[model samples]
Target: MLNLVDSRSVIKIIPYELIMDTVNEHSCHRPKPTVVTISDLLATTNNDDLRFALLYDPPSVVLHQCGGSGCCQSKSETCTHSEHEELFLEIAYLSDPDYVKKTYLLAWNHTACKCAAKNNNRVL
Candidate 1:
């Protein structure tokens, strides 16, 4: 179980890559880039400003798919999932300056735990 501090810190880091992956896998159509509009829509939330800061400009295309369905077919192009992943990771990481420290610490802890687990398994 993650400790309170660790859990809280990790929560600050949104797993945007995972989200994108899930969207890609499940959605019949590509997810829309509505971060700006979403931020506008949720302006009342406590972290609305932060959310907006974290909001990434949805990639123009993913897997050859354009912003909309019919567009990609006409262009005979596909969205680049790898590029989208990179962009999303960049945006997510860039969103919160303050959270950066916490994220790093959390990552270090996770690595340490994984390493320790690996060592224990080897011993066993």
Candidate 2:
């Protein structure tokens, strides 16, 4: 169960099924499945829909992981994506299999070189 807390501390509980409507739970280390339809991918011809699809529920956010190439390996030695777009959904699935199965609201960690154990606001 997820509880959304507002500024006033008003809590709203979101059901698991509602949040996971677009994802499927599978074996760990397997590719995460996307429910985003082909029509949804086609609609991303425009920037707005593309942004929505990439950020909210990207159909391409699966089966990929950073190999410490690109920004995952920086001169600063931190997991910074200043020069490249960080792999978002792939790392999310790697970080938390259980949580990733529940929502597409997954985020990548900018501070951790490997898949992070905790959630962060950073994304591509």
Candidate 3:
């Protein structure tokens, strides 16, 4: 049972399955599986959708650094591309069954440098 407080006057008790079903319905828009890690939840294609999702369900945010690569050079001191790539890599790593079970967050940070390099190429 999950108690959801929509507003001061509106409170509803919902079953876990119903909540998961709603999530699944929303996730069905994407071709990928419904079960997603924190990283995947953060990497939504639509910024508004991502913001809404995060607003409702806050994820465990992780800070990632740009690894001294000129790929993400821009006027801004902070590199948005590098952060996107890191989140993508974290999601990719979490998708792997071998590492997912051990600890998704742990595997995200511990994966080899090659994985990050491979994922970096895919990100814009």
Q: Could you give candidate 1's per-residue lDDT for residues 19-121 as a string of tens digits?
A: 6675556432343432233333234546544454653343212222222321222234433221122122222323665553111101000011111121223
RMSD of each: 22.0, 17.9, 19.5
Give the runs in model 3 whose Cα sits over 4 Å from its true position: 1-43, 46-50, 54-59, 63-110, 114-120
TM-score of 2: 0.18
Give all candidates' CA lDDT scores: 0.31, 0.34, 0.34
Question: Least lDDT summed over 10 consecutive residues: which range in candidate 2?
Answer: 25-34
lDDT of 2 by residue, 56-96 (tens): 32344332223232232224332323222233232122223
Which candidate comes out best when scored by TM-score? Answer: 3
Task: Rate residue 78 of model 3 by lDDT.
Answer: 25
Q: Please list all clashing residue pairs in model 1, or write none if there are none.
A: 62-79, 63-78, 63-79, 64-77, 64-78, 64-79, 65-79
Task: Mark the 10 consecutive residues where model 1 has the least summed lDDT.
Answer: 104-113
lDDT of 1: 0.31
> Candidate 3 on 1-124: residue-level lDDT in tens?
5556655665667888987776555331121112334545446444443333322222344433233222222333222222232233222222332333212222122121111333334322
In terms of lDDT, model 3 sits at: 0.34
